[model samples]
Target: MRLALFQMTSGIDAASNGDAIAAAMDVAADGGADALLTPEMSLLLDRDRERAAVRAEADYPEIAVLRKNARELNLWLHLGLPVKQGDKRRNRTLVIAPNGEIAARYDKIHLFDVDLATGESWRESRVYEGGDAPVLVEMDEQEVGLSICYDIRFPALYRTLAEAGAGLLTIPAAFTVPTGRAHWHVLARARAIETGCFVAAPAQVGRHEDGRETFGHSVVIDPWGRTLLDMEQGRGVGFADIDFAAVARARVQVPALANARPIPSPVRRGMAAQAN
Candidate 1:
């Protein structure tokens, strides 16, 4: 499947940001993309808690348009982290099929609460509630695992998805500049390698109108842990054609999933050794 990973800077204004996302989706469609992916906080990305929550309310205009547009254009759409209808906001991803039906939804499972060396402090949990369930969405002829920015840090999550029979994983993010630079590619590739699944991450880049900066290197990695496409650090849309055959090939050769060995606890091992 040919996919387009869109990179853009999102701001606090929901309407304007919606327009931008719509435009980007159109471009992806024009580029002959079968599926178009956008970044986390695709709606309103303001750090100011009250302001952001207020703006985040409602079925975001962009998602509604993208869903309609996806059905019209016959392109599969996967957008990240729109605030859903709830007293507590949930960072979420919505997958819209070609016919404009809501196929699957994945919430951002891991909250990014960190204090950076750059003196940037983020408390994602303050605004967005962490999701309890791991989302493995079904797309055209494939089982696609779903995650958001912070969830990629946890490898066990990817393993669960793979064990659940996901051939591909979608990780849409608006990772901070510091963290994104340090661990984005490495972790993304690691997940793909560990799971033997194709990983696609479309990210937010640069500073937004709200004065928040993001690290934008939208990447697509094959099951063999090779990067098929990287958007780098800027505003851009990276496109690539992914083949599920590669996933099968990688898993067959490595077969790490089957080779997993179970061992006793550390204390049990020590006792057994002493007894021996």
Candidate 2:
């Protein structure tokens, strides 16, 4: 399947961002892409709770437009992370089928609450409620696992998805410039290699209206951990032709998943000392 990843520099205005997304979808469809994936917070990238809260609605207008576009273009569309109405609001990923129907929704499992050494900080949990369940959607006879930005840090989640028969993993992110520069490609490639699955990461790039900058090297990795396509630090579309057969071949070569072993409970410190 041909996959197109969009690297965007979104801002506080939902309408403008929606137009950009629509235009990207058109580009992807024109390029013969079977699926189009977007970066996190595709609609709005503001850090202000008040501004973001005002736009949070269950039936967001952007979603409706995307649904229509998906149907018209006959493409599988993944809206990276859109804000949803709730008590604390939700950071959600929506998968739209070619028929323009909602296939699945995955809320961001890990909220980014960090204090970086560079003095940059974020408190995502303060504005958004985190999801406990991971989501996997099946498309074109292949199981695709879904995750958002910070969720990529937790290897166990990807392992669980791979064990559950996911052949492709999607991690849509609006990563900070610092973290993205240091660990983006390394971690993304690691996940694909460890899980023996294709990793498609659509990312947010450049500076936004909120005075925050994002790392924009959107990349697609094959199961063997090779970077098939990378959109290095720009606002544009990156495309890669993905073959599911590569996933099967990688798993067969390593057999790591099949060789996985369960761990026993840790021994108490006192008990271990006594035994020694």
Candidate 3:
């Protein structure tokens, strides 16, 4: 499958972000891409709770436009946005099929609550409710696993999806500059190598209207942990070809999934001697 990763610098305006995403979808379609993956908070990236809440409606107009465009273009889309559910909000990823239907919805399971030494602090949990389960959906005969930004730091989530027969993993993010510079590439490649699956990460780049800067290295990694495409620090679409056969080849070579075994509780040192 041909994939397009859109690196965006989304701002506080939902309408502007919507326009950018729509334009990128057109470019992806023209480039013959089967799917387009966009960064997290593709609609709006406002740190202000009051401003963000105003646009976080369940029936967002931007989403309707995106769905209609997806149907017209006959291309799949992986979009990340903040969604309102009753009195709560969720950082969500929606996998939209070519027929303008939602194939799968994955709320971001891992919320980013960090205080970096570089004086950058984020408390994602303050505004969003974490998702309880992982999501895997089928697209063009391929099973794709869905995850948001902070979920990349957790390996067990990726393993669960891989064990459940996911061949491609999509990680849409708006990573901070400090953390992105340190662990972005390594963690992404690690997840791909560990699961023997293709990893496509579309990220937000540059400074935003909300006064936050993001690291903008949108990357695609094969099962063999090779960087197929990297759009480093830019706001545009990057294309890559995904070969499922490579997944089979890598899994066969390593056999990590097959060889996985359940772990038992560790025995205490003194208790071990007594038991013996």
Q: Judging by lDDT against the true structure, name the best candidate.
A: 3
Q: What are the per-residue Cα lDDT tens digits for candidate 3 across 1-276?
A: 999999999988788898999999999999999999999988888888877644454568888999999999999999888888667788888899999999899999988888888777788777778999999999999999999989999999999999999999999999988889999999999999999999999999999988999999999999999999999997799999999999999999998999999989986688777888
In candidate 1 the C-alpha lDDT for residue 167 amounts to 93
- Against the reference, the lDDT scores of all candidates come to 0.84, 0.89, 0.92
Pairs that collide, model 2? none
Output the lDDT of residue 64, model 3: 90
Provide the lDDT at 186 for model 1.
98
Model 2 stretches with alpha carbons more than 4 Å out: 53-57, 268-272
Give residue 110's lDDT in candidate 1 (0 to 100): 85
- 244 in model 2: Cα distance from truth in Å? 0.3
Weakest ten-residue segment in model 1 by summed lDDT: 53-62
Compute each candidate's TM-score over C-alphas.
Answer: 0.92, 0.95, 0.96
TM-score of 1: 0.92
